[model samples]
Target chain A: MFDSKQFEKDAAEIMARYDQKKAATLPLLHLVQEKIGYIPPEGEQWVSEKVGVAIVHIREVVSFYTMFRTKAIGKHHIQVCTNLPCVLRGAEQVMAYLKERLGIDAGQTTPDGKFTLSSVECLCACEIAPMCQVNDRYIGPLDRAAVDKLLQDCV
Target chain B: MASEMVLSKRLKNPGGAWFDAYVADGGYAAAKKVLTAMTPAQVIDEINKANLRGLGGAGFPTGKKWSFIPKDSPKPKYLVVNADEGEPGTFKDRYLLERDPHALIEGMLIAAYSIGCHKAYVYIRGEYIEPYRRFVRAIEEARKKGWIGEAVQGKWDWEVTVHRGAGAYICGEETALLSSLEGGKGFPRLKPPFPAISGLFASPTIVNNVETLCCVPPIIRNGAEWFAKIGTPKQGGTRLFSLSGHVEKPGLYEAPVSVTLRQLIEQQGGGVRGGKKLKAVVPGGISAKILTAAEIDVAMDFDSLTAAGTMAGSAGVIVMDESTCMVKALLTAAKFFAHESCGQCSPCREGPGRLYKIIQRVAAGQGRRQDLDVLLAVAGNMEGKTICVFADAAAWPIQSYIRKFRSEFEHHVETGTCELGHAYAHH
Candidate 1:
């Protein structure tokens, strides 16, 4: 199922950028995720086959960073930032509001799998203290009212 | 000047790291241009010509840092991406990594190729697990497509690894990152040997900020001349400022460093909450000295910020509107640094806690005039005396708050209670 020519082409380009294959952690991850919707549970082994490194090396990387999601999620992943700034600005209330409205706890997907909820740290829009990530896009300074409005708008 | 490109970069079909989506949006075209067209020296020279510096506090020239690696070094050279977005009041990296990890990856590939590194590491904060996972997953996709393995592009051998730090602020420092990569305590080391010349596993390394490296893909693709044209003199390119606090629409903004706080606040942030007037701003995070409402006209650049008596550290613009009690707000700020202190250095470990205690005393309606002087003395003594900037970071708000908001502080002491309403009384 894997296209070796395309693999060689992409690998050549990635190799041209760095001096060693191990340094391609984020790049390799990005390439894999972009190819597959999410990093396959066997991503480390898959990458090991692609990049020619020990699977453990890739495993250590997958285990270390939060950016790499091992589990499957709904079509849209929503993250609520409840860091100190957001918390100070009512991020907890926003999270709770989303929970009550969406009817799912953190890290749980909706029945239709259209949405998944998780608690993110912060999304830089601290001025709008409470923020969230709907997939890749940032939603912020979230209040209970704003969360309701955003949810309605998203649907 | 070019706009803040990172924040404004297209957030579109990332295509799961497939070559088509990346290529469709003009991805490796830049790397191909660099590898076949421009020599490594020429690429570095192009960056030097642009006059870009490290956006991460230190104004080190971008090209100079890259050039620190020897031309013919035998050992593995590395280009490490500093994705450890740990600085309080700073969260731009998370936004970039979350929304556009591909751009950073593209940039990393270009930087590694240009710097003669066949390997790269995106050293991220462990707490940022989700963001880190997305980034790593993206890289995996790149690897499966043969973009990260041996004979990449049919000739170059390169690899990228993601090293995650275990929730330590000091790990943001380059040496600490190297130590964490080596499975050691995340304490900073003296810098006779910088990371560029001697880094990770004693090999030459180029540890660039996530935002900084992310800028490279665009620069290389668009040309250094184009990047140079953006921002202001000496400060090339845009900055991603994380505007927080009591603003109407607080969020991230990517604008030229020339943009004033007022523009970022009034125009982008939708003004203060409930149309409240501005009080002061902790420009560039807690480490930066407080900027009074009167001093909000300063440009958000390295040189301009320094002249205005503050540093553009991480571009974390924490706006403080009126209704904020300077004493209590500062006490909160001091407490964060105190708690986050690594305790590796006494200046930070002991000083921030003591500063918090003093600020608490002042906030709790019990203070002395000498206490003000003691706060200044504490901050002054801590400066340039620690292994890392943590002590100085802990002390800056204390010293700067007292200097800029002396009247408010004196009012707290005079009234034996904060004059501001309940909002200021507690967090």
Candidate 2:
């Protein structure tokens, strides 16, 4: 199901940007994760060979960064920022609201596998406090109206 | 006000101006002038005279940092832009990157030419998807116009690469950023071999913050003296202060370094929300020591803030009103440091978690009088003992919050409840 040939072409292009091949490990891991929804063991091995780094080092990078997830999340991943700034502006209440609305806790996915909620740290969108990243988009200053709209759209 | 705005002037345009619109506004004129007329030494001299310091919290002089790069280095030099805006209360770089991205590119052009750097990398955080896309688009536009590629302006070969960081706050550190850039864990390296000397691929590398780089073009365009005269004698130019939390109008405000915390909060921020009485303010990002309401008269610069017992870290002004609970506030801050600690150094790795647990117990109304002393002792032990200053930063909130708000913390421990809430209910 996965297209290896096209991946090799794209991986090579990414590797060419840096002088050393190891620098491309993050980009390559990102590409693989985007394609497969998660970095499988094979994905790690592929990046290891492509970037010429050992598997252990690849695992280190994957584990170190909070964004890199080994398992697949739900169809929609909702990351609520609970850092100080966001917390200052009632992020705890917002998280509670989302949890109640979705019938799930902070680190859990819905029964239908449609939504995954995560409590994250400062996304640097403190200007729009009480914000979250729904997939790749930033939705924030989340009031009752915004949460309702988000729920309607998610369904 | 229009003329005074340097970095944020172009942010008035909603999605930012395209390359054509940016060029129309005399965007690349400084870079062109630097490449055609001025020598690298002259450019560096101008920056040195301007006194522009790093806006990414360190307050290091930009020109001094550039001058550190060895001119005779056999290996190729690099210019890595620290767009990793991870500080809790700081969001100024996000605006600079998303809006007026060309400013950063043009600034990078001048910087790379001044440092004889042919390659540049912008390490943006993984969370800033929109800003990252907007920045990459700006880079492509510049490259397509031959402003950032091989033989830029028909002068020298250069290229700019955009690298996205996976979420790690420690990666905001220069050496940790270097390690992350090299595709390793975001653990910081020892300092003797600074990045300027033995950096990226063991070559001379200069890592400048996004806002710091965005200040470069203006410094070259206007003479150094004009830029220098705008702010304090030691640190020149305006800063993008991120005013957040309980402010009435929470947004980015460009102010001279001489601007006071009182002016920024009362005047620019439209005073605190709902006309509430101000209780405290984090004059910098979360890391800086907290300032009481009485201390709001101090200026919002590196030197002035340090004199006031706080650093103007990233120029993020977080205002808090009287209704807030200090114990709960410290708990939130402690939780952040605990979660974000990279676990490399023992003090930073272990210290923050302990602070969070202790604060959590105090907030839960199950704390002893001895808990306060233990918190102070643990925080004291964490400071100045780690490989990086993260331990110091984590310790600051514990030390400052307890020291400043001792009575409130004592009330929480003795009565197992917040006095602020009790006072409010009674009133």
For model 1, residues A19-135, the per-residue Cα lDDT tens digits are 445545555665665566557656656677766777776766555445566666787788876554665566667878888898999979999988899875444446556788786
Compare the candidates by TM-score and give the number of the best one: 2
Docking class of 2: medium
In Å, what is the interface RMSD of model 1? Answer: 6.1
Best by DockQ: 2
Q: List DockQ for all candidates.
A: 0.14, 0.61
**TM-score of candidate 2 to 2 decimals:** 0.98
Q: Which portions of model 1 show Cα errors greater than 4 Å?
A: A1-84, A87-128, A131-155, B1-7, B12-19, B423-427
* Candidate 2 off by > 4 Å: A1-3, B422-427
TM-score of each: 0.77, 0.98
Worst 10-residue lDDT window, candidate 2 chain B: B418-427
For residue A127, model 2's alpha carbon misses the true position, in angstroms, by 1.4
How many clashes (backbone atoms < 3 Å, residues ≥3 apart in a chain or on different chains) does model 2 have? 0
TM-score of chain A of each: 0.86, 0.95
TM-score of chain B of each: 0.94, 0.98
